[model samples]
Target: MTTTSPLRSEDRGNASVTRLSPFQPLTDEQQRLVDSIVRFCERHSHDGHAALVMEGDAGTGKSLVLNTAFQRIQSEARDRDSTRSLHGMRNILLVNHPEMIKLYRNIAATIPTLRKKDYERPTSFINAMHKSEQRVDIVFIDEAHLLLTRTDPYNHFRQSNQLEEILKLARIVVLVFDPRQTLKFKGYWDDAHLRTLLAGIPTETISLTEQFRVEANPDVMTWIRALCDGHLLPLPAKQHFDFRIYDDAARMYDDICQRNDACGQSRILATYDFPYTLNGEDHFVQTGSFHLRWDRNQPTHPLPWAERPESIDEVGSVYTVQGFDLNYAGVILGPSMSYDKVTDRVVFHPDRYEDRAAFSGGGRITDTPRAQCQVMANALFVILTRARQGLYIKAVDPALNERLMLLWKERG
Candidate 1:
């Protein structure tokens, strides 16, 4: 007997509800940004090449703005009578993250005007366009910071820089980038390099500053910023937001499960200090008595790691949780981090880090101890910013745990 697969709508609706919907309404700021991007694309559609960059931290809805603008561009490109006057122009959207690419493809299935083929990974898009000897009218890139600056033969990308290759194949390019969320040496990016790339071209930048994800006061935001900046400051009083420092990892998992039950989209996350691999083996993140496997590789699975029901029992990493929003996140600061009593700051030990793939083939980017520290700190920064309503944390280092617990107590 043979079985048939479900319709795309039925499959997506039953499996996952993503945050990257093209139909989601935009705020006034988002709307203005979209209008500006559309205008830029219109001016460049017939001739000339230019770039527009949207800069913001996590949870500022960068993806939302990009998706909305892409939909408008697609509509105008397909409709000759449309007032925007972008008719029969080719366009596509690219994202470096596999999980985010899956989410965007699932979202495209639901929208009538959007096609799954319209979305792709940057590497694949570059190679395919090269083979066809074709140039697109417009290209949209989400999480541009994750684009590879150096070639990786393992990933089948032979080009030196992804952004440069993309610029040569598209008339207009729009990117959403946050340098602080950059996690790997291969994808290292900063303001200087990006500006140098756009030096000769007509470029426009939009900076989004409002915090739209974490439902917290300014003090709480400041505390998180300070912690990621390597400072061990006093915890702030958080009345509206649920912030907690747990003495035990097991206790934090229990509470995260409760949050997942009470409300959907809550999970536990960790830095790259744990042992994990992609060789089809189950590697667990162990802290105290709390042991859960890291997120598995599900190539055939349509749903993202966080959207899967079984993933509640798994611990997410920076790769799985980046560009995703959770109701509550329980973060375990693993062995790579320690509290320095002499300097009164949080220090990162690169030798203790276990994510070997991140540092593999790294050059000047990971040469200095300070640079290695920043890479790990950025991983923690991504983990810390995933929570939308609440944040819970547990540190594996005893001194770090004690410092955080004492700060929590003093905040009360």
Candidate 2:
């Protein structure tokens, strides 16, 4: 159960933030996508406001493809003897997640050509572009769903839409988007919205369907996806993967610690049902004898929350582990999620959900109750997919716990 993923990047232990190196070995499909991206960039380097939308589910190697293509495009830009298609281009990479920003910046440190400054948050990149009145050749945005769609003065993002602003500044904008990963109301996005944004603008969409993170088989993946979509199906048997349900959260934490000791990058994750704040105080997530605190916001911290060894005692939320890979993940489905016997489906309780920021739309998102429920479901989907080798779950709701245990027993 402590087995780490065999495909984990060799450099992960060193950086503790990255799942793959920029030049890490790529599968044939990944390489082809990277090549196509480079060609797209080259062809549209001088074109006006063109976009390449790369859409995929969680763990589809979207970030890897973006990084590899970026490196190649930067190489082409620097090569004097080449066609100079991207020569002297000013390209930047944007990600709204702080943990992802840390990962990419760490990855940039090892490469002489890739500057850490080139990797930035979308808000920062957009603000800098406006202040300088500068236009870039290509802009690569990872986790584009996290981009703010409406003006948020708190984040200093005054734009109505992030992608629209980036398109205005860059000739070719490449974005990696997953609608399922959109967690906050401020950054809400979907295919229709994306199409509307790119209405008159030239664009191409590429979808990646392969599952690259989990070691589980197709049946296991289907079960997980179904559960995330609010349907609780019969739990499937594991194949080449470890999946289990724990009645005692304390026991689950013990196993996660053991996995972390045996292999690195193992941690416990939970839904945002518990109350927490950034007022420099401790908030513990208690379940029976299991006691842990939520991952703190450490803006100056170098390593990601899950990467820090001390984080084993802390519970991570979707924000911390979304783009990172874990050797093993012990997930706590909080009280906000429950199993309804009448419907035989997983139900979300917006009143019980504690992530207030995710619900505060400031008039950007309508249907407040449904939007809050979707936020909870989206958080579950993200935490459920973080595990590479194994997934262990401990449900807080009594009815849900009972139902999950019954389903686990059926996994014969």
TM-score of each: 0.94, 0.95
* True-vs-predicted CA distance for residue 182, candidate 2, Å: 0.6
lDDT of 2 at 7: 26
TM-score, cand. 2:
0.95
- State the lDDT of candidate 1 residue by residue for 1-412, as single tens digits: 1111111111113222345676776678878888998998887777678999999978888998899899888877777677665878899999999998888888888888889999999999999999999999899999999999998888889999999999999989999988888788889888888998888988989977777788888777788888988897777676778999999888898888778777767888998888898999999999878888898989779878867767777889998988888889999999998999899999889999998767765685635567677778888888898887899999999999999999888988
lDDT against the true structure, each candidate:
0.84, 0.84
Span of ten consecutive residues with least summed lDDT in model 2:
2-11
Candidate 2 regions off by >4 Å? 1-12, 15-18, 362-364
Q: List CA RMSD, all candidates.
A: 5.2, 3.6
lDDT of each residue in 130-231, candidate 2, tens digit only: 999998889999999888888889989887999888888888889998888889888888889999988998898887778888888888779888998889
lDDT of 2: 0.84
